[model samples]
Structures are given as structure tokens and as C-alpha cells.
Target: SLFRGQDWLQLNLEELQQSTTISGLLLELVATRDIREGEEILLDYGSAWETAWDRHLKAWTKSPGMYTPAHVMDQVASKLRTDEEQKEYPYADNLQTSCFYEYEQDTATADGAASSSKKKKREVTTIPWEMSRTIFDWKNLRPCSILQRSDSHHHQGGHLYTVRIRNRPGLAPNSRIPRGEMHLVSKVPRQAIRFTDKIYTTDQHLPQAFRYPIGIPDDIFPEAW
Candidate 1:
């Protein structure tokens, strides 16, 4: 099932402190609504990591090395695994400690080999790339398009990240994802005409489709960008 903006079932992470009876990294699968048999469960991973790529892209345009894919993976790795590379990436561990989980190297599978067999130490930073390639299998995932339309007037809303696509049940047959604000400039020539068979409507369908830019607060994490 696809991740919906508001899912009936949610995956929540909670702290497993000594005062609590929960052990290990607390992972709870909660249902906000009653579920019938054979129904699918869905969860939203939140907007923080969802927009991390866009943040990294903008940051990379300014400071190439610091926001490089490798560096960003290092940042995610620092939280996911160990921050042993703290000497090299002092600011990489931006994720809060409440979300941290130790890397269990022994849990990794070995191809038809004995469990006692020796294996080389795995690099924590590469896990992000591996996850992007393997478990997530992003290439086979749903296809998402980035769309933008020029406004006749100089609207600041066109430059802000206010618009977002909603993936929910019971939408119109011809429904389309909202056009994102022009956060990044198109490399294509301005005179170029790009035609598509798809049709998208703005500020007409869902009330949540077009929100005022000022309604959303600025992202608090400046370092993320």
C-alpha cells in the first residue's frame, strides 16, 4: 500500500527508557481506525526525510562537498549506526538521539556460509545507498512527476514549498498531483514548449490543494539545507 498523508494505521517510534517497560527500539504499529480482514495497512514516513533530497540538492549547489550524496548518507548513517566518524563529520549526526539505533553487524546475512565465519567490517555510510537500491527498490516504486507552471504575476507563493501531493482514497478519476512551487529553476530554455497529455487543475479541486505560503512556518533546521 502507498503511504498516505493521513493513514488509518501508523508506525510510531517511541523512546525505550529505563522508566518504561518497553525494551529495545520501541516500534509500535497503531491503528487509528477499525480494520477488516484483508485490508492493507499504510503509514506516512513524515515530511522531514521526504524533502531531504530537495534540501540536499539546494545545499549541494552551494557547498558541493558538504552536501554531496556521500556526505548526506554520512549524516543519515551517523544516526542509523554509530557516530564513530564524528571526528570527520562533527555535524553529520543531526538526527535526535531518541531515533538512534545501534548497527547489528551479526544480523546481516551470509550467503550459504556458517554464522561463525569471519566477515569484513561494514561501512555504516554505505547502508543508505544500499537501502535505496535494495529494500526500498526505488526504481520499481511508483513513478512521481515534478511539474511547474509559470504564473502571469510575480507571486511569492510560486517560490515557496507550500504545495504537496495527497495520496488518499476516493479521489476523482482525472485527478492529478498539484504543481509544486518553482523552488528550483528549470534548466530548459524559457522558449521551449513542453507538451503532455496529462491535465492538472490548480486552486479548484481540493481546498487543501493550494495553501497560502505564509501559512507554513520556515523549516527550523537551517543545517539541513
Candidate 2:
């Protein structure tokens, strides 16, 4: 971490000297004075580091409201019922607008020659807001295979199963999780999706590369990630 205030320690470098052997380089920090107990240790990174830190602070800005762990921007955009509201949206810059075109081929005869293809007709339209948002129905999802079932009986009257969302054609790509990825979901005999009580007792149970857990509601999160 870069500190903008005064630092307690100073950085110093010294060369190592050896007899009847090759010398090596060494780096060390010598405290100017005694440091109080439980006091934070900070280093003076010099004028160059200070200048860079100042520049970063000047350019840094708060994150946009539309940014979230699970991208729910479409849901927010869908709330705008009228064109006036869509035009006046404060975060309209985050939404994407694309033009879709439909083309029709036409055949025409010229100078008694064989039928020739000509520029027939074309129609261009923008995707409606209703169709742009992704509607995920958990009830429609099913287990990928029978082998995905777990033998763990932790959830009373419920079973743990692996599930995934089928690929949907023409739908916008999800920014969070990719398509066809498996996820753990628990469900009772006659109920909607329920939360599972999966816990890690040891580091070996965790994935090789994993991110720290975030505080996000299960409803907002996509079915699979």
C-alpha cells in the first residue's frame, strides 16, 4: 500500500562482503528512531512514488452504480417504460444499442439474359428493451446428468445436484459466468431451488485458484457461475 502521509521507516541498501568467496548484494531498511508498539510500519518511497500516488488519486473515481458482482443492469434498464425515461437514464452509457437488419433477395431478368440477382429489399430495426433482458427461470433448468448427484445427505429431505443453463441462441453474452458451466444446487422433492450448506473444512477441498467470497444475495446471482 502507498502512504500519502509521513512514513516511519527509511529504505537503505548495503553490499555484502565475504572472505575467500564471491560477494553478493543485500537490501535492508534502517529505522531512523525507535517505533512504538503496535504502530504501523510505513516506508518513504521517495518523490517519484509520491508523484505517482498523487496522480492516481487525482484520476480515481467512484465505480458506476450499474457495476455489480452479478450484472443486473438489464433489470434496471427494463424499469424504464417510456422512451423519455430511457433517454433520460443517468447510466445510459453502460447500455449497449445495436442495429439489426433483415435482407430479402430478388431475381430480375435483364436484356433477355438469365435471371440475375439484384439488391432486393432490406429492413433495419433495433432490438426492443423487453427482448434484450435475459429472463432466467430456475424451474425450467434440469440436471445435466445423473452422475452429478452427490452422496452427501447433509440436507434433510433434499439432495445436492449439479445443474447448468443450456445455451440460448441470439441472447446477449453473460459477463459473469460462461455458458455450459456446472454449478451446485440443492432442491427438495417438490420445491424451488434451495440454498445448499456446502463448507470447506480444509484448504485441499478448495479449488486451486479461487477468489475470496463476496457478500451477494443468492437471488441476484445467476444459477451457474
- Lowest-lDDT window of 10 residues in candidate 2? 99-108
Model 2 global lDDT (CA atoms, 0 to 1): 0.31
The most accurate candidate by TM-score is 2
lDDT of 2 by residue, 107-152 (tens): 0111222321443242211111111122224323222212133346
Q: Write the per-residue lDDT of candidate 1 for residues 1-225, one digit (tens) a residue.
A: 334322222323332122343233323455778899999875544565446645655644332122122323434431222234344544322221111111123322323212323443522111110122242322222211123333342333222111112222333333322233111112112111111111232122222332222222344222222
Q: Rate the local accuracy (lDDT) of all candidates.
A: 0.27, 0.31
In model 1, how many backbone clashes occur? 0
Residue-pair clashes per candidate, as listed?
0, 0
